[model samples]
Target chain A: MIETKDLRFRYSDTLPFVLEGLNVTIKRGSFVAILGHNGSGKSTFAKHLNAILLPSGGKVLVDGMDTVDEDRLYDIRQHVGMVFQNPDNQIVATLVEEDVAFGPENLGVPQKEIRVRVDEALRAVGMYDFRDRATYQLSGGQKQRVAIAGIIAMRPRCVVLDEPTAMLDPVGRREVMRAIHDMNRTLGITVVLITHHMNEAVDADRVLVIDHGKLLLDGTPREVFSQAETLYRADLAVPQPVELIYALRRDGVDIPGDVLTVDECAEALYHLLKSRTNTRG
Target chain B: MLKDISLGQYIPGTSVIHRMDPRLKIVLTLAYIVVLFMAKGPLSYGLVLLTLGLIIVLSRIGVRFVLRSVRPLLFIILFTAVLNMFHVDGDVLWSWWILKITRQGIETAIYMALRIAMLISGTFVLLNYTTSPIMLTDGIEQLLGPLKRIHVPVHELAMMMTIALRFIPTLIEETDKIMSAQKARGADFETGNVIRRAKALIPMLVPLFVSAFRRADELAVAMECRCYRGSEGRTRLRTLKLQGLDYVAIAIAAVLAAGIITLGVVLP
Candidate 1:
């Protein structure tokens, strides 16, 4: 589990705080989506999780290890992997397999075992076939998957992705989302995904919304998306189907606003229409 | 036009030279260059030219392509040839005001041009046309690995080199995109005076620099997150090992250099 206590941070003494007095807890092996707009401090919060940035006035503890402890810096990082935006920038090596081997090689893993981990990580991300290909030649989505493979090759207990799909196209976005979901479900690796995309957060076990450097909301996807006004105040929008249901409920249609997916919305509408016709008969 | 710069361009092949270890290739290329400078008289030059020609043919990197590699150096060759043609004093063949051409001048000019051309093509054949840049850097790092005893940071330098090579194409593509965008905005990069045009590039440079710095920061964080401390206990996927072909290539280079030096003493 990861926990932050009264987390506070700012760039300098004179600047306004980017994050202030924030506290949250994340369970082990759970997929959580951090929701926020640009400059809402989501990325800053994610950085503090792995001790990439220490809080100015608070503390972060990852799995009972204090992030501020100097000796446990590498220990904390090894447990929490990070994948950043810009797939082109995060890739360190020219070759796919070599990039995947980077993390393990850094940890002093044996040469033979490093190969095994690299192959496994590539397979996990569904990029084993392109193991020998040059990384620069790959599409954005494939490159992002290779980055994920690099992180997983270290065999971390948790992974944090900071807007990993923001630079990708629609197809690439879906491909990356699929890989993240697979990593969470199959490997049971705790995932902290930082994204503003509403649809991407729908499947997450929990969602934490940040607004003006404060935790504005925290709940499951269904519970969180139900609060349309709060998301509006945060400069965010509800998922499409939830928006539709909210509009219907405003028109006195008695539809629930908790629907997070299109299929659920369709099923609820089908039942609503059926009841109305039976009452007329 | 910028894309025409052929840097570290490796053409994959199955030639005997291509199959040699990259370290051996580098050492041999340096030896061949030293010998080319030592060569003198018609006999040594003839032997050096004959050897280079045979190696070119054997490497299978066509004569036309090798000559094309020399195309960019045309200006330097012309300058050297022209300077040599009129500088050497001997029996005058032609004289006009400050310019004088002699028989010895003509001979020296021809020899100088041939020497420069042979030097460039020899290095190109070994470095650019055959061995890949990654292999070259790997060989360099291995050759310099012992310098770490003196605290030289060999691994860090090699890693930086590899990363730089990897990002060149990416940065080029980015520059192309930024240029087109600026052009579409009627930024007028072409029709301005030198200073004005350079100032016009400020817009492009600013964004590129910003992105570059951002990329460097994020890459540092990502690398640290991956447990990269230094070269302390790091291992590599591809290890450099010298083969029998490498030994033979080195031997050939040594023999050629010794022959050239010996011929320099005996001839003329």
Candidate 2:
């Protein structure tokens, strides 16, 4: 569980605030998708969750510990792990299993326990077979999964991934999302996925949109994507299906504008046509 | 072609030699080098050869693989053999203008040649052909652990070594991508003089350096977020605990070294 209240941050006094007066709470065991255009403070907000960058203004609490407390830094990090954008950058160890075990080793976990956690984490990400393989030998998707496994090995209560799939191919993106969703479903680990991909947010339990360091919108995928005008103003777009439905509605066709998936859009069309045929008969 | 280059020459196996502690393997390999040089007559060299041969067989890395590791030393081995065959003076086997091959010289040539081959093969058996680079670095770190008391920063050095080794392949791949991209843009790296080719690389080098720095910065942040305080209290997932076989291997190595020195004094 993570809670941020009136969070304000900036690189220096000369620069404008990157994140200003942001307030949000991420519940335990829930998947949250933070959607925003580039430089909208989604990533800056994610950093505050694990105390990577202390707030210049307000408070960030992980579970109950404040991020500003120097002594609780390690505890805060252990509770909330972060995966950055570049997979190649984050992997510190040559071997996959060793990289996964990196976090636990840093926490000073015993060797035997670390071994167990490494195996479990790798398996959870579907990368158990590549445990002995070199990190460089893996593809982009596999590398990102290994990064995820590295975070999960820390046994964090929550995970914040900063545009993790931005650099990945479509298949790699799916693999990483599957791994993240699996962690949330099975391990009950709270997940905050910071991404601009509207389709990626479709599967989340909730979505928070940020615009110019301000909280623009917050709701479920249906509620968020339905506000196409608001997202467009923020320089973001709705998922394709939602956009298509919204377009159809504007063209004088009666259809649901809140549809988030292709399947849902197709089913809605089928019902509309079937009802029309019945009325004509 | 660069992509095919393997970083470590580790041949994966479950052999007893493979399972030996890397620290012990490193010490024993150094000790074996000393023993090879101390060997004097046929008996001592024969003992040294036997020990090294046994290790080679136990490592299960194959004789050809070990022999391949000696390929780079061929010129040196030949030069030593050729020099020792004619330079050392004793009973004359043959004589030519400024080149006399003596019976003593012939014996010395064969001995020196064998010593060089055995010395090189001993390294292959204990190191390159068997141990992974990371494990070899780990071994070095543990062996140098005492140096930390003398303000050596051994752990940090080893961590740097491992990190460097880890990034080599990643960086190579990035280089290959950049080279291809530049080539597509009419950046001719080939068909140029030495300086011209070097100059052509400036474009690739600039972007590569910039990206590498950015990666390093992000990696540092990621490492910190994982609670990496330093090497002070960090535990290892694969701690090198000395097994029973390691003790046996160390004892055998000590005996072999002592036997070689004693035989050097005793044998004619």
Candidate 3:
């Protein structure tokens, strides 16, 4: 679990604060998505989770260990893994299995144990078959999956991913999302996914909207997307289906604004049309 | 064209030579180079050649593939051989204008060329063709471990080498993309004189260097997130343990050096 108390940060004294007076708590084994546009301080917030960037004001505590404690830095990192946007830059090894083993190796895990963790991690991410393949030769999706595997190999209690699918294609995005969901659901690892894609947040247990380093909205996806006007004011957009429903509601079509998926939107429209036809009959 | 750039000439295989401990292979390669220089006459060179041939056979990497390592240096090899042919003075085998060919000069030229070629082939067969770049760096780090006591950053150097090796292909790919992008924007790279051609690459190099630095920064952060603190307390998944075959390899190398030294002493 991660808890941030009035977490505030700025790259330097000359620059303004990137994160300003934000307080949030990420629960253990829960999937949470942090949505924000570019320069919204979401990434700065994620960086503080694992102590990659210390907060200039207030504090970030991971499993009750303060991020500013120099002695517990590695311990905090090992407990909360991080995956970055660019998959190519993050992978340390040329080969697939070796890259996955990199985390455990850095932790000084025993040789036999590292191998088991590497294999298990690769299998969990569906990369076991490509374990011997070269890392660069893989497609974008496969490489991102390998990056996720590298993180999970350390057996972290929580993972904070900063726009992991930003550079990926649609298919790659789906593959990465599926892998993220699997880690959260099957392994019971807490996931804090920072993404601009509203659809990616639809499946999360909680959604936190960050606007100018402030927590603008914090609720379930349905509750957050229902307030489409506020999201637009924050320079964010709801998922496509939710956007459609929002538009229909604005036009006085009496459609629900809480729809988050295509299937749910279609079913709601179908029922509305059936009722209209029944009234005419 | 950039896709063809191979960082290390590693030919993966399950052969005993490929499976040998990389530390042993690196030490043996150094010994092989030393014995190669110690060789003087045809008998000693022939012994070295025989040993190299045995290694090539055991590595299971085809001879033609191994010879590719020497192909890039063909011009230098021939230039040295030709210089040796004319520089040495001895009994004249022939004469044409200022070029007088001596029997000793011809012998030396042939020996020199053969030595250079065999030395390259021997190393290619033993190290590059068998051990992966990661394993090679691992071997170097372990071999240089003692220097750490003298304040040498051997692990850091090896880590740098491994990271550089990992990024070569990625950087090459980026170069290709930048080249194509420049070409699309009407930039010329191939149609001018040497200076013009060199100048055209400035646009390409600038972006490549910028992206590379950015990648380095991001990679450093990623490394820290995975608990990488330095060489201290870090363990490797693949620990190099010397097998029986590795000992046999070292023994053979020792005998080869001994044979070459004996041939030098006895023949002269």
Candidate 4:
């Protein structure tokens, strides 16, 4: 669990605030996605969850431990893991299993336990088969999965991923998203995903849309995306399915506007066509 | 094409030598070097060569692969041998203008070349070809643990080395990408004099440096998020424990060193 209270941050005294008087809370075992355009401070917010970047003006508490407390830094980090965007940069080891073990090792876990955690984490990410493979030899999806495994090996209660799938291909994105969801569901770990991808946020229990260092919209995928005009004004787009529903509605097709997934969109269209056929018959 | 260059000389295997504790291997390699330099005569050199031969065979890495490690240094070895052969004055077996090919000179040349070659081949087979780079750094870190009392940042240095080794291939891939991008934009890297070619690299180097710095920054944050706060209170997954094979290897190294030293004194 993470709680941020009017959190504000700036890189330096001269620079303007990147995050300004923003408040957000991430519940334990919940999947939350923060959506924003580039430089909208979503990553800055993710970093705050794990104390990678301490708030300049307000408080960030990881399960009741303050991020500003120097002594609880490792404790806070262990409770909330952060996965960065670049798979190549985040992996500290040359080998897959070794990199996964890095986080557990840093936490001072016993050698045997570290091994167990590494294997378990790799398996959770569907990368158990590639445990001994060289990190560079892996595909983009596999590498991102390995990065996720590295974080979960520490057995953190929460994970904050900053645009993890931004650099990945479509297939790689799917692979990483599946791994993230597996951790959230099977492992019961809280997941805070930061991304600009509308589809990535579509499945989240809650989506917080950020704009210019402030919370612009906060609701479920359907609620956040239904306000398509506002999201567009913030230089963001709805998921393609939601966009399609909105487009049809604009053409006076009288369709539901809450479709967030392709399946839902297809079902709506199918029912609409079936009703039309019945009327004609 | 650059990706084909193996970053480290390690050839992965499950051979006895590969399974040896890297700390013991490092110590034995150092001891072997000492004995190698102490070698004086043909008998001593022969013993040294025999020890290296035994290690190469035990490594299961093949003699050819072990010898390949010596290829890059062939020029230096030949240069040293030639210098020693011409400079050493002894019984002249042949005469040239100012260069006399003496029996002792020839013997010295052969011994010098043999020592250098065996030295490299022994380490390559015993250490590089067997131990992974991570294990090698781990061994160095533990071996230098005592130096921490003297205010040495041994863990940090080893950590830096480990990270550097990890990023080498990634950086190489980036370099390949940058080179291709430049080539696509009509940047000529192939044809020119040495200086011209060097100048052409400026474009590639600038972006490479920028990207490398960005990666470094992101990596630091990632490492911090993983709770990596230097080596303090850290545990390792693969702890270096000496096994029976390691002790046997150590005993062999000790015997080889003592035998070579004794042979040098006895035969001299």
Candidate 5:
């Protein structure tokens, strides 16, 4: 489990705090998605999880280990691996397999074990075939997958992906999103995905809405998307089908505001239309 | 002179030279240079030119690439040829006041110019038409690995070369973007005096530096996050292998060098 207590951070001594009085607790084995606008402190929070940035006030604890403690910083980081927004920024090695082995090698894993973990990580991300390939020659999605595999090789309990799909095209986005979901469901690894795409958030075990450095909503996907007006006021766009269903219900149609997915929306609409036909008959 | 540098513009292809180990290629380059500089008279010069011509043909690298490599050195060749022509005090074929073109002078000037051109062209054709910068640097690091015993920071040098190679395309792309951004703001790089032109570069330079530093910092953090402490215990995926072809290539170079050296010694 990861927990933060009254976490506050300022970019510098003279600057205003970027994160203010923020408090969040993530449960073990839960896939949580963080949604926020630009400068909403989502990325800043991700950094704190890995001890990449220490809090100026309050504390962050990873698996009950405090990030502020210098001795435990590396230990904390090893538990909470992070994948950044830009795929280009995170990959270190020139070849695909070598890049994956980077983290394990740093931790001084044995050569044989490193090779095993590297191959496993690559295979997990469906990029094992690219082991001998030059990393620079890969596409954005492939590169991001390599970055993800790099983190996975660390075998961290929680993987914090900060908009890993942002720079990718539609196809690339699906590839990364699929891999992130796989890590969450199959591996049972705790995943904290910070993204602006609402559609990407629906499958999360929990959704966190952070606006202007304050927790706006904390609930399951159904509870969060139910509050459509709040999301609009926060300058966040809800998933299209959810928004349409919400607006339709608000206009006195008998649909529900809680249809967070296209398939669910379709099912709900089919039932509503059938009832209307029955009422006419 | 620096601006004219063609730098690492190697073409991609499968050829005998390209297939050889870069370590051997570097060694052969050195050996070839030693032989060429020691070479004297027409016979040795003909052999050197002929060997280079054959390699160029076998490698399938075009004559245009060799010409391009030699183009920038035209002025230097002409100056050296002129100097050798007037300076050599041997059997005169033509004369003027303080200017004499002796048989030895004329021959020496032609041979020197041809040697320099052919030598440069040969090395470049190998470097540019075959080996990649990454492989070249890796080969160099492997070759220089012995220096680590003397505490010479060989790994660091190799790392620096790798990073520099990694950033060249990125920096070029960044500079292009900055130039375009400034152009959008009506900044002209072409229209100004020496001072104005230097000043005009300020906008482009500042952003390029900022972006470069940002990229460097990002790279450092990324590298560190992966636990890259240094070269200690690090291993390579593509280990340097001196293949059968590599040995054959070396033998060929040696034969050429021996032939050239013999011609240089035996010629009148």
Candidate 6:
């Protein structure tokens, strides 16, 4: 489990923070999505997860080991691996297989094991074919997958992707999100997806809303979308189906349901139309 | 690795030098250097210079690139000339108080300058213009393959050299970015005293060094990830092969050197 208590971080004490008084807990093996508008302290909160940014006050722990402690730093990092926004910055190796093996190698894994892990990670991420290819030649989606494979090879219990799909195109974004969903479902690895896209967060198990450096709301995606006022107050938005349902209900349609998924919304609409047909007949 | 250092600085061309086998090119360069020292007076030096200039022209590399390569050594050239200017004791052609200009001094200065320029330009033709560093180092390693019997780490050294060459541009690019970023943070590297300027570079240098170390660490991890376990049984993807043209080229260069050496000494 990842836990943050009263996590207040500032670049310098003389200045105010982009993250303040943030208290959050992430359950193990759960897909958690953190959503907030720009300048609402979501990115700053994301950096604090892997001890990339140390908290000025309070504490952060990855599997009971405090991030504030120096000896537990690498362990914390290994446990809670981070994939940065820019795919270019995170990838250190020219070759795909080598890039995948980076984190495990840093932990001093033997060459044979590293080979196995590299191959496993590449195959897992569906980038096994591009193992020997020059990273410069890889497309943006391929590059981001390579970066994810790099993090995956480390065997982190929790993978924190900080807007990994932001730089990608529509196709690239879908490809990356599918990969993330597959990793979460198949590997059972807990994923903390920090994104600005509401639709991306729709399928997640839990949603946490941050605004002005504080936790504003936390619940399941459906439960959270049920409360429309909170998201609006936080300057955040809901998924497409939820937004459509809310708009229809606000337009005097007697839709008394919270719709998170497209299929769920369609089913709800079918029921409403059927009832209307019976009443008219 | 840094990508802009021009270490893999091969300019693709259909010139004779570019087409020559790398190993043969290495052998020819060594032989040429040896012959260059044998160059005695005006006739031999003139032949060497003319031959190099011809090759440079054929290579189609810009004069500016060659000049840029030599620019770093300008101080050394000037120093050697200045030293020879004062130190060479010979026929005193003229004297202006302590600044005496001798006939032999003038000739020695010109010869030294010409020798330095010819040596650099010729090698630059082989290295910077014609062949890439990776190929060059590979050629050197292959040529020195026999040293493996004597327990020389020729492969390892060659690998190290290639990596160093590869990272030159990467590091330069990193440094450029760091400088720009630090400048954005209002760090002034220009318009300061020597100490102040040095102090101002702390932010830039710190980040650059951090990034370099980070890259090195990451590269090491990546290499280990790829199952790289030193110079034991690695095979080359692009093995070097010598063609008939390579032998003919080397033979031609050998004969040219021989003819020049013979005519310079015996005829003189």
- DockQ of candidate 6 against the true complex: 0.07
Per-residue CA lDDT of candidate 6, range A36-129, in tens?
A: 9998888888878877778999888889988888787777777877776666555654456656765776676767777887888788778999
Clashes of each: 0, 0, 0, 0, 1, 7
Candidate 3, DockQ to 2 decimals? Answer: 0.86
What does the lDDT read for residue B184 in candidate 5?
A: 95
The alpha-carbon deviation from the true structure for residue B69 of candidate 2, after best TM-score superposition, in angstroms, is 1.3
Q: Report the C-alpha lDDT of model 5 over B113-206, residue by residue, as the tens digit.
A: 9988987898887776678776788888989989999998987898788777656655665677888989998999998698999999998899
Spell out the clash pairs found in candidate 1: none
For each candidate, the DockQ is 0.68, 0.80, 0.86, 0.86, 0.28, 0.07
lDDT for each residue of candidate 3 in A1-281, tens digit (9 for 90 to 100): 89999999999999999999999999999999999989999999999999989999999999999999999999999999999999999999888999999999999999999999999999999999999998989999899999999999999999999999999999999999999999999999999999999989999999999999999999999889889999999999889998888888899998766688999999999999999999999
Question: Whose lDDT is higher: candidate 3's or candidate 4's?
Answer: 3
Per-residue lDDT value at A28 in model 4: 90
Give lDDT tens digits, candidate 4, residues B1-268: 6654544878888989899899998998999998889999888888988898888888888878977899999999999998888888888888879778888888888899998999899888878889999899999999999999999999999999999988888899999999999999999999999999999999999999999999999899889889888888899888888988888877878888899999987778
Stretches > 4 Å off in candidate 6: B1-268
For model 3, fnat equals 0.82
Model 1, docking class? medium
- Show the lowest summed lDDT stretch of 10 residues, model 1 chain B: B1-10
Question: What's the C-alpha lDDT at position A38 in model 4?
Answer: 90
Candidate closer to the true structure by TM-score (higher is better), 2 or 4: 4
RMSD of 2: 2.0
RMSD of candidates 1 onward, in order: 2.5, 2.0, 1.4, 1.7, 4.0, 9.2
TM-score of 4: 0.96
| Stronger candidate by DockQ (5 vs 6) | 5
Model 4 spans > 4 angstroms off: A277-281
What is the per-candidate TM-score for chain B? 0.92, 0.92, 0.95, 0.96, 0.94, 0.84
Q: In CAPRI terms, where does candidate 4 land?
A: high
Over A1-281, each residue of candidate 2 has an lDDT whose tens digit, in order, gives 78889999999999999998999998999999999998898888898999889999999989889998999999999999999888999999999999999999999999999999999999999999999999998989999999999999999999999999999999999999999999999999999999999988999999999999999999999999999989999999888888888888989998766688999999998998998999999
> Which regions of candidate 2 are displaced past 4 Å?
A278-281, B84-87, B91-103
- What fnat does each of the candidate structures reach? 0.74, 0.87, 0.82, 0.87, 0.20, 0.01
TM-score comparison, 2 vs 3, better candidate? 3
Clashing pairs in 4: none
Model 4 agreement with the true structure over A1-281: per-residue lDDT tens digits: 78999999999999999999898988899999999999999888888887778899999988899999999988999899888888999999888999999998888999999999999999999999998888989988899999999999998999988889989999999999999999999999999999988888988999999999999999898899999989999999888988888889988997888887899999999999999999999
